[model samples]
Target: MGSVEESPEEFTVLVTGFAPFKSEYPVNPSWEIASRLPEYLPRKDSSSSTLPRVRIVVYPEPVRVNYQTVRKLIPTLWGPNDPKINPPPGDTDAGRSFVPPAKIDLLLHIGMAGPRLHYALERVGRRDGYNLRDVDDQLLGDTAADRADPNWVWYGVPAALESDLDLDDVLQRWRAHSTDRDGVNHDLRISVDAGRYLCDFIYTSSLAHLWKQGARRRVAFLHVPAAATPERVAVGQGLVVELVRSLVETEWAARQQAGTDNKTDAKESAAAHVPADGADTVTGKWYRD
Candidate 1:
């Protein structure tokens, strides 16, 4: 077996939000939450070890908000090994030296929705035709397969992909600790629909990409209902932070366990004098939740 690389003291997460697409909605609540989450998220692990950096990407433009954008975005989150995808600008925490690129383990995208006081945890995103239009009256990616890429045509890929998240666990975690100012219980809904617009377009494409990569990475998109009141904002913020924290902690713990298991397996194999194969005995290849 090759040398085992120890787990880093910090683990990274990438959170993203879209910019305002229409004038009627001046502020995207999703952006508001994404912009503020890092401050509220846990910066340390359960053992008080330093947590990895949280990279934030806020797309300021609404143009081409579809699969193509996400195809480009994926490499950035994962760090661009391919030159075609330019990594976003480097981020630096205040007073700290320039931080190196983050090794992302979990990813979350936030988008705004209408006047419902609930979160829609999308179960699946479909590529089936909808002919729905976006803020600019453009046909959503629901029907256009190759609109994002002029040179490539997509024909045989699955029409839909399920979100790789145990949303029930996320909802349960949120309910355990979160409550609205009105004393009414906040609600979470699991649905197949992601609006069949840019939201679904991005979500489906993002998850498909991550799924192809591996199970070690988790991806999900959240639809935040319109937050017109201070109470709503507070609840939304709390919900987002808790869910994110829970997911990150859970992923980190699994990685640690896999590391331990790999070490034990390697020792056992060596004691038994097993012939070595061309494999990293200390590096687990897959994880799921």
Candidate 2:
């Protein structure tokens, strides 16, 4: 009888988007794009069959554009327990709890970039230098005082943290996969600054959480134009799907290379211990014995 072959593992991604910043922008494009994502990533082509199944689990509600709200919510999203965000009023699933996947392999946070025409993948999450007030008219606190305070949320955390995913490799894959699709030219690039707004605050909080846990910072922040038009939302959604695919592909390739290197090192180590004549020098016996 022939042995059975196991299917590839499924990669689970947790996505979140912030609520509207102010009355001027009634609709936040970030949540619009994130909420519209399909449960599973759409296949690019038949050749992608070998890639692991990608499951996208978007947070149930739009995260409030408040500093305190995000600070309290980061742990709930990344911790072992199920998410604790309350469902928005009139939600159909209000009675039943919305439980995300048991294990989340990646986190993607989306935010609005006011007046910007292009999309940007943030490279760094800054812990200090936040001066903007949240929608609720709250500040993260004086940067100097917060750093000096022992009980502050970011007291001991690093001033900046970057994602563990390789941005250069992911960008290359993203450009290749998202090129000229639907005859729409998408502008995507990596940015070192996240504007020190709630976007940066949330990004820093997520990265710091993982840092404290001694875990890989598999987190990404995407800043998209504030346009909430149906056309813009659709385009944003497409870009997000491709970005997720790029991330998964890059990580998969890296793991494969690491495994190959380990095998080669093992072979070289074994060969070194064996004498040139294939005899064990310590026992004067054949290596096969």
Candidate 3:
């Protein structure tokens, strides 16, 4: 535990889990859902104060291997990303020494199957709409969306990636593990085939590290089951810490509403690319909702 450096306001979320290739009492459920995610998080400070920091960096279980061996399996939880932790530097205004040389945005990848989950925990087959063309393949798609079905996949934040927190006060603080609305996981339903293996090798290799290694930071993949008894693996590890905090607060409120609609379409395309007195004020507001 030495190289601890990261900041971009404080981030990192690469949780992963999966190892018993075919089970035999090896404690699975995606390492109890990446050991319950929550190193710290408060946000709000720009003098607006409330701060708290330590955004998140819960590791353990990307087993069938390779995330550049994730800094050789947790290099003090990896780092590199800190645009001066909001004015944090030289000495110590301290957002933990504003380091962040790599922020480490996202990479979920959880696992556990028994009823029917195929497509890439190295079983191959879910190419394009999120990868798995290898690792043994298996995600033939179509497993029925319906989690109220607003949307399910498509990321981009830096692979891509936030905070205030609300939405039904955060889905009633964990819709009881989508256990069909709290019957205590209604006997754990099983049938998730998203494909490629470690949940499609952590969502098609973190979107192949942003369309393939350019990894700018967002990545995902999840699958869970096997707790009918065995004392319900601590009720499936308290509903996998409320489904990994509702999948990181539903992707941090869709990347803060797509970064406020791309900064209101880049300030109306820089005021329609400059004009007013110089000759360029053309207007055409055509929003249809």
Candidate 3 per-residue C-alpha lDDT over 86-173 given as tens digits, one digit per residue, 9 for 90 to 100? 3221111322233323556555556766554221112121323433332334433423442234453322322121111222233433
Taking all chains together, each candidate's TM-score versus the true structure is 0.66, 0.80, 0.26
Which residue pairs clash in candidate 2? none
Model 1's alpha-carbon lDDT is: 0.55
Judged by whole-model lDDT over C-alpha atoms, candidate 2 comes out at 0.75
Candidate 3 structure, TM-score to reference: 0.26
Model 3 deviation from native, Cα RMSD in Å: 21.8
Better of 1 and 3 by TM-score: 1
**Each model's C-alpha lDDT?**
0.55, 0.75, 0.40
Query: After superposing candidate 2, which stretches have Cα over 4 Å from the reference?
Result: 1-8, 82-96, 142-145, 148-150, 263-289
> CA shift at 244, candidate 3, in angstroms?
12
Model 1 worst lDDT run, 10 consecutive residues: 279-288
Please state the error at residue 247 of candidate 2 in Å.
Answer: 1.3
RMSD of each: 11.4, 13.6, 21.8
